[model samples]
Target: MSVSNTTDFTNPSTFILLGIPGLETAHVWLSIPFCTMYIIAILGNITILFIVKRERSLHEPMYYFLCMLAITDVVLSTSTLPKTLSIFWFNSRGINFNACLTQMFFIHCFLAVESGIFVAMAFDRYVAICNPLRHSTILTSHVVASIGLAVLLRGCILLLPHPFLARQLPYCRTNVIPLLYCEFIAVVKLSCGDIRISSYYGLFVSLLKNCLDLFFITMSYTQILRAIFRLPTKDARLKTFGTCTSHLCVILVFYIPALFSALAQRFGQNIPFHFHILFANMCLLVPPTLNPIIYGVKTKPIRDRMLWLFTHKRT
Candidate 1:
């Protein structure tokens, strides 16, 4: 590995992220694929947001959450990529504590909101499955609004105190972040003082929310499965399972990487930094970026409607 000896890594005031290791030599070539993914991620998510908001036909709980998820995806990707592009191409990796804290805040907020939305989506599926007759009534406007507010409130409240723990700590040395974004934990790990308080606060919030969310999600699936098993017809069972198939797969994809990353980070596992970056990207990339694709492919009716709307609007 050729070290850029000219570029100082020990700069205390401004941090320099290597962006992608060994990519500085081929900056243009290295950026193409990442830029493409960013573009596609941006476009796909924005399109979903546009479709959800614009089309009067898609005014439902599923689409509502889908739109929220799209918003999260765009925010998540935006939080990382601009800095990445700047660092990789322009070598401008300087980020102050307040700026870093602000980025970290939104990232955590959106992440919490994303998790809540997914759990709500799971509950929505369970409701639709278990109580088909009253699905509409159960998921009324008031209920949906309450759920949205809950997601937002939970996101903001938990993460609101984090910036205090971060901004107060003196980053006396290199502010270099290993991963792409100014992630709260990763950035806080670089603080000069003892981080026990920050860790405890973060961990308390994490373990509490994660365990509860997982428990409820498990209960929901278990109940849904039990309800499915009682079905008299094979077609009914198949349909019941099919409805949640995409959500299940996506939830697994989203949660597993996150769980692994959390464990690896907390346990101080000897995971390679690059692998850490990869998984970090995967966690953010897969759910927000691939969710629309999953929904589009799994729900043929939605795909048809989307294309029909596009075609009609074009002509």
Candidate 2:
């Protein structure tokens, strides 16, 4: 939405987003499919959250982290999807500068929380396999709660200062963000003046959060593999692999595109914006919608319960 008398320092009144070049005409129609996908994704994540909340059998540390993953996915998807959908459905890309900053803040916060949750889940997996005897005590409910709180606090701390950086820049250029929603890099690039320091800070935060998170997750998985190999029984090995399969898949789908987009932004290697925007968006939408189904619908216990809930069939 447009703010009151807030003018771009260069253009004073108008801000054009150089949007997906020529697709503005078709965006209104495209939103139909976008909305459909979003509804399904949002509902699926919510279902996962509800299942974890209701099923006492699913109260292990893995599931606890899974529940928080669902929460972060919901927030992350909601942060951008609705706004992007609105622009397409209504052709109303009237986001003000401050409002754009708000969106960026939430997007970064949710992304950070999701990354932290992934890292914590990896740690849980490591403990479950490499240190089975201590898993129960090491990952008690209180410990899980504490981890969630730490993630929340860390997300807020990481993103809160980012908006202030935007506030420092005088928007002396065209206001059009080139993307549908207010993407941080795209928005920051719109500044007419130098933003070397801003870009440096952004790079620092991105690296500190994403690379470090991926590093720890990888470390955990490496240990898990060693422990799985150490198991004497084939059944034990299969069980360990089975439990980690869902999370491993999630990590792949969530990380690859995100890391690619981060690289594209940092390097500016002349990658097409459309490609960047498309994959970048998929990073947000695809995971949240698919995770619940991949994790829950495919699991024997969850599938049976879900089938019973829907069909009223008794085993």
Candidate 3:
């Protein structure tokens, strides 16, 4: 609460991100795993995208949604990891204020977009299973394009104010952010003066994006389940339900860690600070890492294509 009175905010405008404090000696060891995970996420998503792009059979609403998800995963992870890797590898922990804001913006924006894509995917599944006859007409190319545009615009518009609001604060306090990246909350916490507006808006935006997205996703899945159960034949039921397994796995990986990370920040004050930081990092990393694996393994078509891609290359 004791902020410095004389430090000029505009003159020396850089924030130092202390990535995993007290683990300085272990940074090299830590970087290995972090670097490995980043590679896997990037390669996996890119592979998914390549397969989705090349295969004509995947030119459907469901696969289109998966493409959106893959793109978001790549951007979200890339936005944070480069700077994070710089910190661990080269000890370049200083980030310019503007650069920090940009990072925070993209990080949250991509996260919002990813969440929106999940909802879109859920709706796609609902239509595909519950109303199979109308599925093609319901989620046509135009509709999919509109959904993609809407998702991007929604994330950008909703998250536009966050960085600017944080920027308006007089940062006379220590410019050190205690996180692995330039997170909105971590940056806001460093600012001087009343930040109630920033904090409240942050909470509101989080609830608005994640909570609403999760709610709609859950509702869509509920209907999907109902529709699947009503099917008379076991084969019909299995085939219909089977299509959703990949998406369901993706939802669990994304939402569970994300919810826990959010809760850890909001209410886990009694918990260890390091635990919260690690959880937040995991929230960002785990989904990107696991999503491709989940889809590739559970979705038979994708798995077959991936295998063919490798085998044909070897031949």
Best by TM-score: 3
Off by over 4 Å in 1: 1-13, 263-271, 310-315
Per-residue accuracy of model 1 over 1-315 as CA lDDT, tens digit each: 222324433224444455555445765675676677788778887777777777677888878878777888889878877877776687675676567778888888888888888899989989998898998999997899899899989999999988888877766544667656677777777766788889899989888677888888899999999999999999989987988887887788778989888777668577666666767766776676677777777766567777987799999
Q: What lDDT score goes with residue 39 in model 1?
A: 83
Instruction: Order the candidate numbers by lDDT, best to worst.
Output: 3, 2, 1
Q: How well does each candidate superpose onto the true structure, as a TM-score?
A: 0.88, 0.90, 0.95
Q: Cα lDDT for residue 204, model 3?
A: 97
Clashing pairs in 3: none
Can you tell me which runs of candidate 2 are displaced by over 4 Å? 1-18, 263-271, 313-315
Off by over 4 Å in 3: 1-12
Model 2, range 1-315, lDDT digits (tens) per residue?
443333446523334444465566777776776687788878887887777777788888888888898888878888888878767766666766667788789888888998899999999989988888999999999999999999989989988887787777767656767776666667677777787878898888889999899999999999899989988999989987888888888888788878777788679668776767666777778888888888875566666667766786443
Q: In lDDT terms, how accurate is model 2?
A: 0.79
User: How does model 2 score by TM-score?
Assistant: 0.90
Q: What is the lDDT of residue 139 in candidate 3?
A: 91
Clashing pairs counted in every model? 0, 4, 0
**How much is the lDDT of residue 66 in candidate 1?**
80
Instruction: Look at candidate 1 and tell me the lDDT of residue 288.
Output: 69
